[model samples]
Target: MTIATTGEADALPEILTERRGAVQWVIFNRPKARNAITPWMEDRLIEICREVDADPAVKALVLTGAAGDKPAFMAGADLSCLQSVKTPEDYTILEDRAETAAMALEAVRVPTIAALAGACVGEGALLAACCDVRIATPSVRFGFPIARTVGNCLSIKNLARLAAILGTARTKEMIFSARLLTADDLAGAGALRGVVPDDDLTERTQELAEELAGLAPLTLWTTREALRRWRDHGLPADGDADLLRLCYLSADYQEGIAAFLEKRRPVWVGQ
Candidate 1:
């Protein structure tokens, strides 16, 4: 995790929170890096998720990126930022922060809506999967492009969540191909609440959040728990850390990260 210096707590938060009527908006605020989050940022988001859970007045949550000229919801982790890692332990610290935030947000009693635009890749898309619903604009693109880029493995929790939403076959295809699925593709696969034009995304998201907020509270909480439990059930308990080590420790994995930063194709020896 990124540690703050003596008084870094006085600086602005990495993630931004805004309370709007009955909705709590959690925006991924790292715009220059496409909202690519650090371990510290993930911790902040997880804290926000917990705070929202404690507030009964917050009936719903809306997640989005800070809309900029390019407007990425969130993309793959900043390649340059991740290149500092030298050990499995270091990498796990970063990955686990993101995973913990996803689970925290997903477990909230109130519903979540990910209003996405632009690219949502890797851990970013994993966060969207945690939301109770997703809506996006035509400009949105979603994928895990690590196969061609980082060569890192997904955590068991992330893999299970993907499998639950897209099924095993489709998830495998997505990783193997390393292609970004467009908004339409994600909608067709049941990962989205259908596409809205870029201009209407905000309005549509608020409308959906309102609808969810007005539903029976007990039913919403119960059904969400029912869903959250199924995701963890029956997952393979063995070999997850081994898989992470085998891949992240490989020469090819280093090559992948280096080549990506250098804007060249990685030469993989597979060992």
Candidate 2:
């Protein structure tokens, strides 16, 4: 199936949701910004996740970046959205919305696949990690390069998620080095279900979705939940809510965001 498009000019919705047979596609549609996530996008995605999760007709989901002049899976949070965040309250609100969306996606109770390519970073990486499976092109670059760019911290929940996928030492190296790993590297580490040619990405993702859609929905969902429960067992009871507030309210994080928007290097004062 051709990747679905809307409008004559292909004007994209923030969250482009399409139901194809028993598979649901929740596409991130801000390709110009590398599908960088916005707050509204977060809310729309959560709504879509809940909608599909509740639908008995839907058995699987495929999430990807919308086709654009420059195709990208997802780069992270939109810098413009980051610009508006000033206080701890502002940051908390943003994190809460993201957390809500992430939790909703995790709770979908269906097989979920992330069709990732190009650049997937920061929050985008976290989103992909939340999915049950990931597929990407060999050239894809992804990681939480916050140390070099945003200077913001991932909530312990997200850190744990990545750690579970990539292991503790590799996770440390990924963050501390502030480098994006090639798709091959991540795949070799068992982070991706498979790696395909760049041109075959969409088709491969669709094929996998269809295959998953044929499975017993109840069995698939229960297995996903079982793995999630085991993963959650490692998390601290209180969660990492406070960590988000701490980093979001920091002067270094503010400087990082401002510098990124200004297209300059961030001068970290380490507040």
Candidate 1 wrong stretches, greater than 4 Å: 1-13
- Tens-place lDDT digits, model 1, residues 1-271: 1222213422546577777779888877766677787777778878888888899999999888765557678886766557866698876776667777888888877998999999889878988888889999999988898888878888787888887777888888999999888887887888888799987887888888889989998999898889888778877765488888888778888888899889998987888
Count the clashes in each prediction. Answer: 0, 0
lDDT at 2, model 1 = 23
Q: Write the residue-wise lDDT of candidate 2 on 1-271 in tens digits.
A: 4554433214756877777788898888776677899889888888888888678888898889876665578899888777777787788787788889888889987889999888888789889999989999876788988897878888777887898789989899999999998987798789998999978997888899999988887888888888888888867855776777667778888898888878899998778
9: Cα error in model 2, Å: 6.3
Q: Give the least accurate 10-residue stretch of model 2, judged by summed lDDT.
A: 1-10
Clashing pairs in model 2, backbone N/Cα/C closer than 3 A: none
Model-by-model lDDT, in order?
Answer: 0.81, 0.83
Estimate the overall C-alpha local distance difference test score of candidate 1. Answer: 0.81
- Report the poorest 10 consecutive residues by lDDT, candidate 1: 1-10
Give the clash count for model 2.
0
